[model samples]
Target: MPRTVAPARRHSARSRRLRLTAAFAVLVAVAGYLTVQYVTGGTSSDQCTVESADGSAGDGRTYRMSSEQAANAATISAVGTTRGMPERAVTIALATALQESGLRNIEHGDRDSLGLFQQRPSQGWGTEKQILDPVYSAGQFYEHLAEVPGYSRLPLTVAAQRVQRSGFPQAYAKHEPDAALLAAALTGRTPASLNCEPPRSTAGTGGMTKVRAALVRSFGKDVLPATDGAGAETPAAGAAAGALSVPVDTPLRSGKGGTAQRGWELAHWAVAQSEALGIDEVAYAGKTWESGSGWRTERKESGTTSIRIQLAR
Candidate 1:
């Protein structure tokens, strides 16, 4: 009457292995989610809900970007790249300040330094007014960086210091890792990666932000896009197939010549960085032009590098 019971089957090696694999996968996912939250300023999942495709003003209100500041950031990053500085350089520059100045057009710094890159005016950097100007400040940093022998090959801190000359040289080093991450996103070298949910359109700066959004659209949303190389011509202005569809007047690019062309220079430069940096296209003055899938690069015979973001014409 006391009938014997059968023993339960044990898990085979394969079953145990599967369980372990699943556990590892879950741990990895949880870790990744936490990382994104911390890096994005501990943003709530709800905060970044507005998808980039919806495109109105964006979640910009939370981050406090005016359209103007956003536009300027896009333009400046584009200019830096088209001029032939590496993506690492741009990210390092952007991150140094993202850590130090939070990307504002800052007017103050340690002692007498100022602007995004925080170059000090007291050290023969430039006048207060000049350092505060983003374009000028960025250019100055680039100029000094270019002077460092083999700078491109040097460590980020060493290369940045060749320009920054900061008292806290080590401080610049920590920023390098983050800067490298951002460089991929901001430079269009990584596409889809450099995105933010700054304050929505209504609350942020206006004019420039719209321009930046258009630029992102014209360029690929991701570092690479299907259309990137097809229509995104490699016409190097004077090159055989590189010439623009419309005839360009020589005077347009001169001090007294290329009026709109001058602005277009900035626009195209941004587009040229489409591939390696993820710039898909640039839109300005009512026209949208595509970009090459190759870092949106261009080096003119005249020693000038250029890019353009056509407006939605």
Candidate 2:
């Protein structure tokens, strides 16, 4: 056979082998990229980072999230806390959503499932539009989760599976560590733990009106007082135009943390919404987060009880 092989045949076979090898390499590269994206949440410009609850960043215990994922997670935490659900409940809900939708409010899933939690309207989760709304869907999830007997005491997977009834019940367990980190930051138990990068564009539709509306939508009307013009509590005196101050002194009925905790909660929420809300800076508890700079210590100690949200003009 070696003696019978022609030069042209040999070249053709070699070319075919080369093409096949190159194609395989490309396939592997694409697969690797997708797997990384799925695991890291995103590698795009609009990304977010959440450090550990203790505020240690050098330990390699951070969780990276896409801007979309951060925003959805913030909504989930807000919905739960405003409903008086504890941090554990928030952790369970977040883990469930991560497994079901990777924290994305998707429009498609297995057999008519939809939205972040992949609730199926056919199963009476909600109408398509309702299921698609993050706030509503999260609320529905919490409502279901609250009904589970001793959900707080159960294992995270057990609590989540009781609500989701997923074919893969154990899937939620793997996400617990990451979910706990997110819940800690978003729930305000971990101060300055969450930070997001500046958006690519600030020219989108934005204003304090939109910001106030988003806050009320996620944390409920109580998130902002009925006064201060847009349901935001009284603005601080001498504040600049487009600056909105959210007072955190008002105690939450069953919410976790004290005033400082609430302040950080609002601060982190603003950072998570920065890209979409056109926020330029967020200051709370003597720490400040600028659009491009992330978080910096304004002082070691201060009496700041309200979160100041500065919007880009």
Candidate 3:
């Protein structure tokens, strides 16, 4: 039988309305302002500030990264996961972002190309429709790339070349370090604390998971194969009892920490969305992301460490 929408939906709708109000208010202030570069394929002058997931560090100061860059990075990360690719895939993607687009995701670019990856329809990248879609372009890049045997073992450039076949092949190299930093953040190897200000109020909010599901539905699952290492975290997702295993009393951090249930909820969520969210791991409070695909404690950090959801797997 089809399950009915939970009564919680009504309450959730109300909470979402409130949160949207709050999120939009912040968006207006930060929208036109110069936001920091969260991470990207080009050199960045922005300095990073670390904050807990709830948004804070030692001081009361909030953390920051390029809201513009973060969206591009987040998009790539999500697309790669939707295709079931691994961090290496994100790394390669970063290289592509470096060469094609500076990860800014522009509407207009060299010639008729658009978006961060500068895909050109004149060059046979699907129609403007396909090229403009970051997820579609990324998936297309991966599809061609995976066909090149030993790509994972190839030098990043050689591997990238097999796919991009660009005129300026060497240009892709300069973006490596920048791409790596972004790969860490986008792939969840860094920290969620390294987040950007809210996006334009016009860009609706469903959070990462909701966005991910929509992307999967849009792109066929075959874009990423099961054998892809991207499936690494599936085990961890199952470790938790509920689909949304986050316990009822999960802790909420205000630069402090949440209860174990909250931490568990976060950990479970991290693993559950590892592939789709393009996150390799998540670290909150004392827990570390390490369940092959989920977080495993390597060494626990003690003290008033805020509950930071770092992407550094």
Q: Pick the TM-score winner.
A: 2
| Root-mean-square deviation of every model | 20.0, 10.2, 21.7
lDDT score, candidate 1, position 273: 28
- Model 2 misplacement above 4 A: 1-46, 54-57, 228-238, 253-256, 299-302
Better of 1 and 3 by lDDT: 3
Residue 1 error, candidate 2, Å: 61
| Candidate 2 residue-wise lDDT, 49-138, digit = tens | 999855474664788888788889999998898898999999999998888888888786666778899898999998999999999999
Better of 1 and 2 by TM-score: 2
Q: Against the unseen true structure, what C-alpha lDDT does each candidate score?
A: 0.46, 0.82, 0.51
Best-first order by lDDT: 2, 3, 1
- Among these predictions, the greatest lDDT belongs to 2
Which residue runs does candidate 1 get wrong by more than 4 Å? 1-76, 198-313
The digit string of per-residue lDDT tens for model 1 on 4-72 reads 544433346567889999999877655643443244333232211111222335642123233233444
Off by over 4 Å in 3: 1-65, 191-193, 199-313
Cα deviation in Å at residue 172, candidate 3? 1.1
lDDT of 3 by residue, 1-313 (tens): 9978888998899999999999887675343221212223346533232243433355433423344455556667656644556667778887787566666665665446666666778878787877777677777777887788988778788888888776557777876766665555544444433422232332222343453354344334432113226642243222232222122131222112234422432343343333334443345655555323333444756322223322222
